[model samples]
Target: MNNKQQIEKMTDMMSKFIALVSYKLPDDVENKLKELSDEETNPLAKTIYNTMEENQNLAQELKRPSCQDTGVLQFFIKCGQNFPLIGQLEKILRDSVYQSTLDTPLRHNSVETFDEYNTGKNIGKGTPSIFWEIEEESDKVEIYTYMAGGGCSLPGAATVLMPGEGYETVVKFVLDRMTSYGINACPPLLVGVGVGTSVETAALNSKLALMRSVESKSENENAAKMEKLLEDGINAIGLGPQGLKGAKSVMGVNVVNTARHPSTIGVAVNTGCWSHRRGKITFDSDLNYEINTHKGVKL
Candidate 1:
């Protein structure tokens, strides 16, 4: 196919994939929720889990969005330097967002800053925010599509801590935020904690952390240990499912970190609510695709 045809095909596939993501939770998330539900002992918490499961089922059966607030769309792309569509990748993603807005009927969540006007199309100055990572000597592009609802997105925070404060302070910062505002994001949340050299980097890493599988542990030994401690500490808070009090406060705590400057310890927190709507799609040089986050499904 010509470039125009290739772009059109990819766009169409992405539009449908976005719509699918809206209605279906990724396999890791769905499985985690199920495990949590089975482990929960409280009657009310169990009921809430049941309702959540029902919601998922109904959304898929009816081909409708699981949550009313689809939030803002964000794409985290790891593009191969040699990927054929590298030049057109940005335009393709933008077009996919526009097409998905209409086809998936995503909630109009993009609003112009200062102007206070809705974009209606979910495309504005920076709507459908895209983050890219270019891979060397590769021929496959991996794209992560995430829908960050307002409730969950609202709890995101980043800060630079004094060097002396140490990693203990990082734990304290995350705990403080989770206890104070995590309830607003809906319970059984998947928490993403990022540690880097600065606020911006930390913030971005925090969001990236959210995209990791709930079952995956950080490669860094210290970071992995921190993930366990934070997960236990957060669950100890008793936020439970829907924050109504249950056996666990969160689905998981994921930490993504990078070496930081000696002068500062930057940390950030991002949460994904019960219905964490995100998916991963990878395309080869030939444009063949594989959906990693969701299985037994085709776009």
Candidate 2:
């Protein structure tokens, strides 16, 4: 195909992908939900899990969005210098989201900031936020697509700490937020925690943490340990499915960290609801693609 044809093809693929994730949970998320369901002993929580499963089944059978709030689209991209459509990716993703909004009949979620009006097409100025990382010596691009719903990612929290506060303060910040607003996210949630030198960096890293697989751990040993500690602590809260209280409160806790200034600590927390509409797709130089999040699925 010519360059124009390639671009069109990519856009179509992405729109289909958006539609796919709108209704179907990622494989890891599905399995984790099932695992949580099987382990639960509370009658109410078990019934809630069953209802969630049934909702997915009905959504797939009807080919409709599983949630009423389809969410604002977000893309985290890692593109290689040799990727053929490096320059056109931003436009392509925007176009794809617009197309998906129409084709999937996604809820109109993009309202221009301070302009006070819904764009109706889900594509406004920076509506579908895109974050990028450029790879040096490869010919493939990997993209993580996420639906940041109003109750989850949109309500994420961040804070800066004094030098004496330490990491314990970070834990307190996260737990406090969870206790206050975790139910608003429709738990059990997949929690993403980020620690960096600034609020913006921490917030961005927190979103990146949500893009990871449900079971992924940070490469840093301390961060991994924090993940486990936080997971245990959150589960101890018994937020359960739909925040009704049960055996578990979260799918997992993922921590992502960066070296921070010696005098300061910055922390943020973001979350994904049980449906966790996060997907990873990779395209090579020739545009051959692989779906990493949902197995045995095609777009």
TM-score, one value per model: 0.99, 0.98
RMSD of each: 0.8, 1.0
Off by over 4 Å in 1: none
Across 148-167, the per-residue lDDT of candidate 1 in tens digits comes to 99999988999999999999
Q: In model 2, which runs have C-alpha deviations exceeding 4 angstroms?
A: none
Cα displacement (Å) at residue 284, model 2? 0.8
lDDT of 2 by residue, 1-299 (tens): 99999999999999998999899999999999999999999999999999999999998888799999999999999999999999999999999999999998799999999999999999998879999999999889999999999988644899899969988899999999998899899898999998999999999989989988888988999899999999999999999999999999999999988889998898999999998998999999888899999999888
Error of 1 at 181 (Å): 0.5
How many pairs collide in each candidate, listed in order?
0, 0
